[model samples]
Every structure is written in structure tokens, then in C-alpha cells.
Target: MTQGLAAAGCEVTLLLKAPVKTDRLVAPLTGVPGVTLRRPYEEELLPDLGPRGLTPDQAVGLITRLDTENRFDLVVVRGRRAAIAAAQAEALAGRLWTYLTDVPQNVAELTSAAVSELTDIAVASRFLLCQTEELRDFLESSVPAACGKSVLFPPVVVVPEGVAGSGTPHTPLKLVYTGKFAPRWNTLEMTELPAALAAQGVPAELHMIGDKIHRDSPDWAKRMAKALEDTPDLVWHGGQSRAEALRLSAQCDIGLSWRAPEMDASLELSTKVLELGALGLPVVLNRTPMHEELLGADYPLYAGEDIDSVADVLALAADPDVYRRAAERCAAASAKFTLDRAAERLRGYLDLAFPAAPAGTSPDRPLRVVVAGHDLKFFTRLADHLMSLPGLEVRLDEWEALRTHDQYRSKELAAWADVVICEWCGPNALFYAQHKRPGQRLLVRLHRFELYAEWPRKLDIDKVDAVICVSPYYADLTRERVGWPADKIVVLPNWVDDEQLDRPKLAGAEYTLGMIGIAPSRKRIDRGLDVLAALRRRDPRYTLVVKTKQPWDYWWIWNRPEEREYYERTYRRIQRSDLLADGVVFDPFGPDVATWLRRIGFVISTSDDESFHLAPAEGAASGGVPAVLAWPGADTIYSRRWVHEDTDAMADAIHRIVSEGRFDAARAAARAEITEHYALRRVCQLWTDLVVDGTAPERIQLDRFAAVGLG
Candidate 1:
């Protein structure tokens, strides 16, 4: 849990029984980032932090102070009175859980605390619920306060080495056991099975590798010695380190853990079963609902918890094919219990612990920010930036509702968030604007397409806190077209990450022209071809390159009746015109669009109207001199040199830049303009100030952003 959480951007602090002084012990953990290793109490204060060595008061006091100083989100503890201390530590921690072994005393102890406190509980298994009849009702009814808090939390294994098949033909079916040999485990019955198997002409060897029994079971040690002495084939290797034990187990065949059905400890999912299962060693254990859930009902090695049933496994292991199939099932079942995968399930177990921060609460907890929409291609950098902050948790669920418009699922997601920014002006914005839980701060960003869509006008503008626009042009257009409140709308220019886009252009790329989007008639594909024709007429080497999804693949355009004629004309022109047929190039849109954009000397934006014209901004960041056509709001966003009145003028400017050998200079100038106006950090800071600090967009002085200091 510590290793996985630390990797997932959580600041982890590991508390230990003793200070790790050895260099070899600490060296491996040195490079795990954002992890702090510390011991809360001195060794003298609590020698082993045991019930006898130190009082419960001392342990609780030390844990509570750690919670106070470090601000722990959850306090998870296991075994005896430590569970009691953890349940009481709920006062200081965000959430608390007592990981209990699935036994009668464990359930009773937690039930006593559940009535007094509100801590979550994670029991070992739901064994009683599935196997026992009357006890199932008693288990859930025992702790009324822990109705939804308790869960079956099984131990997860870290299967480092490859899992090997247990059965090897003519290898005496090397049976091994790694855990204790207690009477409750039916160790005497297990030990006698090897000799009985040898009498059946299926020779078997058993290796027992364990240190000691549980605290109260010292008598089982003497029983284990007598049983091993009686059996010639049973050998005791004593204790082995966990790593070496796992390695040694891989060499063995059938794993044995057949116990009586009445054994209380065996009722839960055993760690011993998992240990053998993870190593692909098929365990000969009793069949139960929990066992079936772990290894599936088809597991051939399951016995009736009897000595004769365990001896039956030797007959199967003697057969190469049947043993191989059973071994495969064990290996397959082990995959789900891996530490990393279990850590994800652990998140679900920990979810009920941390309650949702109430709306308008102080920054005492992480500000929950949820960015939800279909077209959130632009919000990734900002979302990532927010997550890296000290007191913020950002979740970007782009295209979450693409399969269905299920309102209930969307609301459940919205309840956890303090602020919800609907990226595109579509169904997500419409849904949140209508279903908003009153406390959530809703901000929806509208681009050009949504201005034409019906959902924008359908939005409940009253409930929306703000409408973010990539540029003032889009803000003005949406205000007039969609009739949204002018006061609520603000221009926060789309962020362009300059560092990732900038790259060296290919040799002889000074003559190549690039265009990003080529769909929707307003883009004027013919005009782009005309401009390219003029440039190509001057020099045949001048080619226009387009990188976007192929036109035929756009299902929405094909579905729209009005777009049919436009596409037909565009494709006909593209097929007939020599300049387009030969001089123009097209490639599918991919992750490396910046690399494709870098090969062009100039990027032309020929759209009739645009809110932000991200293609030209991205092209400028890619060190490509942008040749932007004059649109209604183009001049406000870009300089006059980039904006041209017509196709001929756009062609003339490109010609002038090439003729004067100013491609490098123009590229540098374009990059500098984008750097000054549309840098990622600079724009994200504007958004941070608006959503987090509640500073109005108009109040944000872009020139004085450096003075405000983003960090």
C-alpha cells in the first residue's frame, strides 16, 4: 500500500516498529520519490509497541500526534488492541479503519467500537456470509453503525518472479507448505497423506517451511514434531525469509492446507492459499464459497477437508495433463491478488473513510476539481497542473458519458467535487448546469461549434457560475448568438505548451505550407488550394501539408445532410486540381502532430471564423510562421503581419517571407509572440486565479502575472 500510494502522487510516510539503521535495508527505498521513512515513538518508550510492553494510551498518543503533524488522510491498523487504537484515532485522522482478521473476537471487538465511533471496518472475508446460515445475519446485524463500512479485505501478494507450474512428471509430486503446522490446520492429517499416497504407488515428498505457530498454540509445535518424526517422506526445513520461501515454493508441486470445516480460522480466505496460488502451486484445500470465489469452482485440487481427500490429489498430480490444467488455474487466479492490482481495490475500500469536503469549506482539505466533457483536448495541461498543487485534487473525466446520457451516474460524480468545469458547451455542460447540487461551482468553456449547437441555448445560465471562452471573440459571439450573460463570460486564451511543440524544422522545409483542420465548408479548403496554387505557380517546390483525421472517417459530417454537397465539391476539387493532387499532402492525426507541424515553414489559418484558432497558435509554437487569413476576430488574437485580407495576399506574404529568406526570422517571431501571449503556465495561472481564488477574469492583469507569482 505504501509503495503503490507513493507512486500514485500521494505523500507517504512509513511508520515502523523500530528505526531502520542498516544501510542495506534503507538503500532500496531511497529512490522512491515523495516517501518519508520515520518512527513516531522511541524504542525505550515502547520496546515492541505491545500490549504488555506499553499501555494503549501511549500508542494512541503517538499515532494521534503523527496524525496531527502530518495530516494523515486515513489511519489503517491491524491485530489486537492496535485495532482499538485505530478506531479511536478517528478524532485526528480524516478516516480510520481497523483491518481485522475474520474471527469472532475481531468482529465483537470492532462491534463495540462501531457503536461509539464512526471509523470504517475491513474484515478479512465474507466467509460467514456465504458459508454459515444464521451467523451471516448476525455478522451484519452485529454492527449497525458499520452497515456500509466493512468489507472483505484479503491480503494481496507481490508475485515478483514468473509463476511456474507446480506439476512436473515423475518428480514425486513435491508437496510443500509455507505457513504454521497448527492442529486447527489439520497438520497431522496432512502429514499422514504422503505415506498413504506412497502406498497407492504415487510417490510424494512433503516440505514444511515455517517458524512457529500463533501466540496461543505452542502445543501444536510438539504435535508437528511428532507427526514429522512418524512420516519418513515429511521433512522440516524450519523457517525461511519470505523472499526465499516464495522462491523455494516455486520448486515444489502440490500445496496442502486441508483443514476441518469447523475450523474458525479456515473460514476466511487464507494467506497460505494465496502464497501457494501466486507461485502456481495448486493448493489441496477444502471447497467453500470463499475458496471458489478465489480460485473458481473448476479448481480440480479442492478436497473435502479430509486426509483421504488430500491423498486423492497425488493421483491427479501423477497425471501430467490434469495437473498442468490445475496449475494453470492457480496461476490465473493469482493475477487478481497482485499487490498493485489489490491496491486499486484498496482505494475503493478507503473511499468511505474520506467524506466529501462540504461546499465553500476552507482550504483545510484538498479542493476537489472535476473537469468533465467530451472535447476536453485542451484542458489536460491545466488539469495536470492543478493535481501537482499543494491543496488540490483534480479529476479530468473527458468523454465519461459518451456511451449514454445517464443523469444519475453523472450526479454521483458531481457530488464529490467542489468545482466542476464542463470543457465543451454540450451535453455535459447542459447536464451539470441543470443537475448541479447547489454547492458546486460550475464553469463551462464554450468554443465555436457549440455556438451553433442547440445545447448552449438550452443551458440553465442562472445556475452556471462562469462561462470561459478561449478568446474575447468567441465570448462576444457566444454572448450574441447563445444569449448568455455578458458579465458571466470571460476570455481565458487557450494555453499552448511551447516547450513541447518547438522543434528544429526539416532541411528545405522553408517552402512547405501546413494546414491543420480541413473539414466544414467555412475552413475554405478551396481557398487554401487557391493560395497554394499561387505559391506553387511561383515555385513547384511549395507544397501544402494537412494533418487531421481523413474526411471520409468523419461520421458526423456524413450524417449531416447540409454537408454532403460541400464535401462532394471539395473532394472533386481536390481530385482535379494539379496543385492539390500533387503539391498537397495528407496524413492521419496522431500523437506526434507537433513533429508533423515542425516540418512546415509556414502554417496558414484559412477559417472564415474561429474563437481561438488553436491550429495557428499551435503552429506558431512549432516554430512555423503563421499565415492567418483575416476573419472577423482574427486581428484581436494575432498580429497584422500574420492576418491577410485574401488568398492572394496570404500567398504574397508567404512569398515575401521566402523571397527575403526570413523563414527563420519569421519562425522565431511567431514563437516569441505565442510565448508572450499564450504560454501554458501563464494561461493556467489565469485559470487557477479564476476558479481557485475566485478572481474575476477582467480583474486579472496579464502584464502583472509575474508580480502575482503562480506558484
Candidate 2:
């Protein structure tokens, strides 16, 4: 919604509920014009209510203060309290347009009563609009008719937030469903839709968003787990803000409009459908009279009564032209129901509700905002970059330094920061829980190390506003093992500053193979040794140069006696032999690895599992042939099919590198490709967009963050 309004030339100020340190909401929205964010001081106005629960009085106070300070043109309510608050603010301001993203049924009766006071009630779908109708009718019949004067606009569609006019339609039949996975609305039913499609040989996937509903219902959660187990095509995720949800939905070829068979549901249309259509995604909606009536004959596929019909629709949607025409029709229909159009229609109603302000008003300067987080080095760099922009002040809170200065722990440091970025391996959730402030955006970067450790189990993902992963692979692993919403996860691959590592690629170094980093178990030093052995066995001219930090026991092992011995006997030998040999060399000093990688001809990784093998990525970036073992976790976590395994295949790859003499061209091409995807500029841009704008692109949401919660 922010992006859509920003694209339409509206300056945006996002009032987050909590601190945003990670790129969950901002990275995807960066580079977009006309949007600015403000990190307001968040205060917990209602202590009795938890994060999801807010009372009418508390809601009114928050909205009134925010509106008084900024006077927004349109106020969008996401959760229940937010809706009520927006409505109250609209009533007070007497001219603010209001839109609700969630189903009205989810809100408390009292909160709903407050929202009914708004000038206009906007829903995402015809189904929801009807649901609003039922609630209105009930309220009117129960109360006085004079109390119900709100207008209902069913199914207002907006372009998927952060997606620009790409000119080409989305391909590959990708379908995404963004919502909570509660039983009342049959959320889990869609979880099985993907596997059902795959079973019938229809290529399709269902990306589930939002937190697991019935979380306390062990039987239901377990059944949901079992149902989605081994469903490779199904990507389950948890709750996310509307901005993050739409950003993710934009990457799909189609948007799913499937809801449970509720009388109220039949009258609603999903926000996903509107977003997908706005982003040029064709849609497959459940057959409902309103959908049929609004969409007319242009409805490409309809799952009338059976879930199996979804597969049939998906199979037909695979054709590019078929999907394109459907998307075009949906887009044409969506423009009629956009927030801009809705706000225009609602202006008169709003004017009637409240008196107008004095004329000749000047807009306030873009909100001066600051975001703070952990890893001072990274966030400092980010802060520096963001500070270069106009009307923005970015700060970095180094908890370690703060402790030195004031003897305060992580909690104290977080309380002083607006946006907190904690290391995935650090005490993120604990600090946030201890010193949480309302309107502070909590962003956490889930690095590769945490994915393999018990940290994920310990972390409270629900408290986190967004998580930035270095790769989609790690994000998927975290989602599968940890159960985080894909929308809340953003994949911002590691950034290497090309200018800093601009040393020329080494010439005539074809025989030198390099392996960087010091990890043994996961890095699989044994595989690199085996590759070296194979190369030497083939020709004595072949040699290996490994740069791993020493002492091997200190650096690689976890202080276990047996583990230390294993490292000393196996990995240390490779390191020691290479160091002692005249031709083979090993440098365990803390020198720059990128410069060394340029001097080597190839890089190898024999890992059991990797979120993303950074060594190989760096090696490839430095103009080396990358030979990586097809790791295990990718298949279960991300449905990966790009690994090359057999020992012979490894040897064959090595032989091709040596015999073909195509190393230079291959190296250049590999460098170009990896740099384009993982360069520091590109990666930082992703972070900036996600952190600054609070939008997570669909591809990053799906491929990186698999699902929310510990599934």
C-alpha cells in the first residue's frame, strides 16, 4: 500500500509498531521513488493488551496522536486495533481515507464497533466486503440504524507493493496465498493444494503466509505439519505486515483467491488477488457469485467446489498467453478499485463526517527517521549510506560499546535505539523482549551460523519485525526448521565491494586450487583434500593452496577432545602437508581472502550442508572455477536440483577446467554472474529497500524464507 501510494507520487511515512533493524520491510521498497520512512519513538500505551490485542481507548489514543502529528491523507489499518485506531483518527481528522486489510470478523466486537464509525469501510475482496455487510447488518439490526452510516467498498485492488511496471508478465505458473493459517478460514486447506497439484502432474506451488493459527491446538498444528510434510512445492510461512505480504505475492505468476466455504467468505475477494493483478499476475479464484459478477467471463479458472479444480486451473495457467490475458483483465478491473479511486469516492463521505481544515497549508518535511541495530560495522556502514540521503538520520547501537560506556546490557541498548539489528547468532529476541518499545521496528539478520545451531529454537521469531538472510537457501532452511513466515524473511546475499577487491585475476595459475574459511565439518575440508588428491593423481603438476585460519583445533573444533583429535588428524594433515610442501601451499594467516582467490585457479567445497557456501562464492567472485558438492539440506528445504555430486563428476569437472583451457572465460563469466547477484551494491540495495521501505520482494520471500514458525 505504501509503495502503491508512493508510486502514485504520495510521500509516505511508515509508523512501525516496533523497531526495524532487519530488511523485512525496507529492502524490497528501496530505490522506489516518493517514499520516506519515519522511526517515531514507540511507547507502549496499553500495557494490559499484548502485541496482538489493543483496546478501543488505547487504539484511539495512538491514532489520534499520530494523525495530529502528521495528518495523513489515507490511513490503512492492518490488524484489529490498527483498524479501529485508523477509524478513530479518520473521524477526528474528518478527512482521512481509511482501508482495512484484514477480515472484519477477526476484530473484537468492541473494536468492530469502533471501526463502524469510519466514513468508509474498504475490504480486499468481494467476500470480505460481504462479510463486512453481514457484520453491518447484524450491528444495524441489533443497534439503532442511525449508528450504521458507513459505506462498504468490496474488493479494492491495489498493485503489489514495491513492484514497478516490469512490462513483461510473470511466468512459470507461480501462485502465492498470503494470509493467516487459521482453521476457521480453512488456511491449511491451501497448504495441501500445491502437493495435490503436483500429484496430478500440474506444476504449481502454494506459498502460505502468516503465523500458524490454532497454535495451542497441538492436534491441529500436528495435522497441519503432517499434511504439509514432504510437500516440496508447498512453502508455508507465518504472519507479516501488508507491505511484506504484497511484496512477496508480486513474484508469483498467479495469485490464489481460495477461502473456506463461509457464507461471508463467498462475498469477499482476497487482497492477494488485487495485489497479484496489479502486479500483472493472473489469478485463480474460488467460484463465488460476486467474483463471477465482478470478474465477468474473464475469470480464467474457478475452483467452484472441489480443491482439485485448483490443479486444473494451474495446468491451464501454465501457458504464458493464457496467464497474460487473465492478468491483463484482472489489472483492468483492479484499477477501478484502487485506494486512489476508493479515496476519491470516499472524500465526500469523509467531508460530511468532519469539518475541513484551514486552506494554504504547507506539507511537513519528510519525517526524520533513524534505525539502529547490532553488528555496528554493518549497520554503521548502512547508517552512513542512509545518512547520505535527504531527511534521514541512521544510527548504529553497538551494545558492546554501550556496555563499556554505561554498563548496560543488550536490553538497555535496545531501549535507546529506534531500529535494532541483532546478529542472528546474538541475543536478539531476548533483548527485544526485555526492552521492547511500541513503534520500534525490530529487524534481525539470521546469518548462516544460526541456521545450523540451536539459536533458532531459542529465538522468539514472532517478536521480530523482519529477518534478513544471506541467501535464499539459508532462509528456506530457517523456515523449514524454525517456522518463520516467508514474508518476514528477506534474502540479501553477501555484498563484496568490487572496488575494494579490484586486484587483477592471477595469470597462469591454472593448477592452484583454493579453499577459504576454516570450518571442517560443514566446509568439508576432506572433499577439498580428495579433489586435490584426484588432481595430483592425474598429474603431479596439479597443486592446492588453502588459506584457513590456524590453529586448526582452536579455530575449527568446539573444544571436544574427540572433535579436536579428528580435526588434528584429518583436516590438519591437509593444512600441514600443503604448508610444508614446496609446490602445495597453505596460508593460515588472517590475510585478505579475495586477493588470494584471484591467485588461485579454482575453488572447491565438499560440504554436507550449506545455507550458502560463502567461500565458493568469494572464490568465484575472485575469478576462480567453483566446484561445490550438491549439499543435502537444499533438497528438503528448498527443493534444490542444481547440485553435482559423484566423485567422478567432481574429477570430470576438474579435468574440464584443466584440459579445456577455458578457465579465463569461465572465470570471467562466473564472476560476472555471481557479482551481479551478490555484489555489495546490489546486496546493500536489497537491505536498504527492505530496511528502509519495509518491502520484501516475492522471489526473496518464497525462495529465501520458506515458512514461519518451527515447522
Highest TM-score among the candidates is held by which one? 1
lDDT tens digits by residue: candidate 1, 138-166 = 34445443332344445667654664543
Off by over 4 Å in 1: 1-364, 396-403, 435-439, 559-580, 698-711
Clashing pairs in 1: none
Model 2 CA lDDT for position 539: 71
The residue-by-residue lDDT of candidate 2 on 637-690, one tens digit each, is 221211346555766677676787776776675566557666665665565566
CA-RMSD of model 2: 27.1
lDDT to native, each model = 0.69, 0.57
TM-score of 2: 0.43
lDDT value, residue 682 of candidate 2: 65
Report lDDT (Cα) of residue 446, candidate 2. Answer: 72
- Candidate 2, residue 391: how far the Cα is off, in Å: 3.8
Which is the leading candidate under lDDT? 1
